[model samples]
Target: TTLLRQIAGFDFPDSGRITIGGESVERVPVEKRRIGMVFQNYALFPNMSVADNVAFGLSVRGEAKAVIATEVQRALDLVQLGKLGGRRPHQLSGGQRQRVALARAIVTKPRVLLLDEPLGALDKALRVDMQIELKRIQREIGITTIFVTHDQEEALTMSDRIGILRDGRLVQEGPPEEIYNRPKSEFAATFLGDANIFRGDSTGDGIRLADGTAIAAGVGAKLAAGAKASCAVRPERIRIARDAGTPDGNANMLKGQVSKRIFAGSNSTYFVERAGQTLKVIVQNTGMERLAEGQDVVLRWSPESTVLIAAN
Candidate 1:
């Protein structure tokens, strides 16, 4: 929120510059920054009709009545709320009201759109629908959008490029695929998604766990021997099996006993205890027999699924 506020001119930066469209706007006032912001709360007028709420920005700017009407309809249609212009905030659902807020923001054709947790108020199902709808509208208009979301799934679903901030500093920035598959740090790996982290000493090719289990890194991992390092493997990448016999091929393997099992609708999560550490593994419910708790199991996965990270 602080970053969005700074861009919207609600707060000034302590140092450095804020540029938009190849121009500096450090001293620009809020209203003159050509920014459209939608807060977590819709902030619509209770007594006004949808059209009037969307027209408020243009109306305040003394835009002509004809121009306001045209722009308001255009914005409403863009948000898929064209037919609800006569409705009041009280008559609309949470999603509809959010669309009204978006229409209001875009009617003025601002250079940048700032969304501060716009979907925070919606329920799970509605939030998913709005995620798709929001992406569609963004692509249709082709406006530069700065979206602020704490939900990792929302970030992965909506972002073309992601900037991860940690401790008031930018830690990593990249496409979603790169950040997820090749996290530069342990924090980034576990933050964006679930990771089974194994802390150990680097062996030039991989890291040797405290139990003396050698985990080979991915194809391009490069680390000096005898350095503090860690390897991260996502839960879904590890496969669980009942057979104790070693499998063929150059796959990493571990022997553990299932400590706990959770059955979600589409998948099952297993907690396996090995060498005083609990490793999580997720297996899709593919009609195969589920592994029971307290059963000895073999965890197998390709070395390519492992990501090596240097300890901070």
Candidate 2:
């Protein structure tokens, strides 16, 4: 109820401002806003065949029969579901039904499109297909879209820019590359992907862990020295080298005993334990060079790959 009232152009001081196409939407009507929405659960009428469903929106608009048919066909063609128009929702696959719902929302050529969990109901393969299809549709239509989903992967894969929300407040918003590579906060870093948060305790140029193992974290040791600061690095960036000799530099090397290793076909994960903390490293599948299950390996990372996360 509150959302509808707000989207209908009311403003709440605490919630901040909302805008569309350079204009403030505080006084715009739903019809004038030109926004389209597609929900989860394939919210199509079960009894309505695919063609009727596509034409439903045009019919409600009092468009001519000839125009409705043309628009319906165009919409179906847009989603690549034209051939299945004669079939009902029950007759179509989960992916196909979602396409019908998408066609209905997009046929009007609205200025903005909003999708709420559009591919949640589909299986993995179907979900991947729909992800590409949705990206293509948004690009071709050139509509400013705001997609809402709890899945970070979906948001990262789809949006032109991601708006990360938490606890009813927007915490971060940025391009996918920035969000993935250089998260502004520690929470955003851990929430979006796998991050190993470690504390750096150092006096000068030397950084030591809890167990007195000194290493280089690629940081200058000026900011994190004396004061406790956090370090964050991606799993894939942690390289496993089997050399017995110690690393030349002290900035980004750590000695860890391989505690657990799991092979998942295309990729593998290693859990290394040192100083009572488990660090993770992701290895790729190069059939020729599979890492062993148990090896006291040196976890190495480059200065560029290590992200010095600030203490919260």
Candidate 3:
């Protein structure tokens, strides 16, 4: 929020430059920068009708009443809230209020839109609905947008690009899939999603697990032998079987006992313990024979499933 505030000119950065639409905006006032912001709380004025709220930006700019009406209606329609314009914020549902706030921000056609956890306050079902709605509106308008949220799934679902910030520095930035699949550091790997970390010394082909098991490195892994390294694999990439044929030598395989199994409707997560290390595997719920606790199983995954990251 503070970063957005600085870019919106509500607060000035101590150093560094802010540019929008090819113009420097460090010294520009908040209202002059043409950057729209939607607060997490929706921040709609309770006293104003949705139409009036949407028109506030253009009205403050001295747009004619006729023009304001047309633009406000267009903005409301863009957000699919056109019919609710006459309703006050208090009368609208959470999702409706969020849309009104978004409409208010974008009615002026700002160069950029900043959404600060715009769906954070909504119920889970409504949050999912608004995520789709927000993405659709963004695409339709073709406006440059920056969304800030701590919801990993939401970030993965809604973004064309992603930037992960930590300790006040940008630790990683890339398309969601790229960052999620090939994170550069341990922090990036675990923060973006769940990762099973295997820390060991690099062995050119891959890292030799602490148990002295040689697992093949995933594609695109870059590390020199003898250096400390870590490999990450998502639980879903691992396959577990109770009596599958022995895997080829090229495959990374381990024999373990099912220590636990968690059922989650669409899938089941199994915790397999082998050589004192616990490995996680996720399998779709296909109504097949499910592994029970204490059952012996083999976990197998291809080299492509592992992601190498900096140990530090």
Give candidate 2's whole-model lDDT.
0.76
1-312: candidate 3 lDDT, tens digit per residue: 789889888889999999886788899888888889999998888899999999999989999999999999999999998898899999999899999999999999999999999999999999999999999999999999999999999999999999999988999999999999888888888899887778899887678877788878675468889789888888898878886676477778878999999999999989888887788888899976888899998878888888776568
Model 2 C-alpha lDDT per residue in residues 4-34, reported as the tens digit of each score? 3455343333455667777887666666676
Error of 1 at 198 (Å): 0.5
What is residue 259's positional error in candidate 3, in angstroms?
Answer: 2.0
TM-score for each prediction?
Answer: 0.97, 0.86, 0.96
Residue pairs in collision within model 3:
none
Q: Candidate 2: which stretches are off by over 4 Å?
A: 1-15, 201-227, 244-246, 287-294
Model 2 C-alpha RMSD vs. true structure (Å) is 3.4
Best by lDDT: 1
By lDDT, rank the candidates, best first: 1, 3, 2
lDDT for each candidate structure: 0.91, 0.76, 0.88
The TM-score measured for candidate 2 stands at 0.86
Which stretch of 10 consecutive residues in model 3 shows the poorest summed lDDT? 243-252
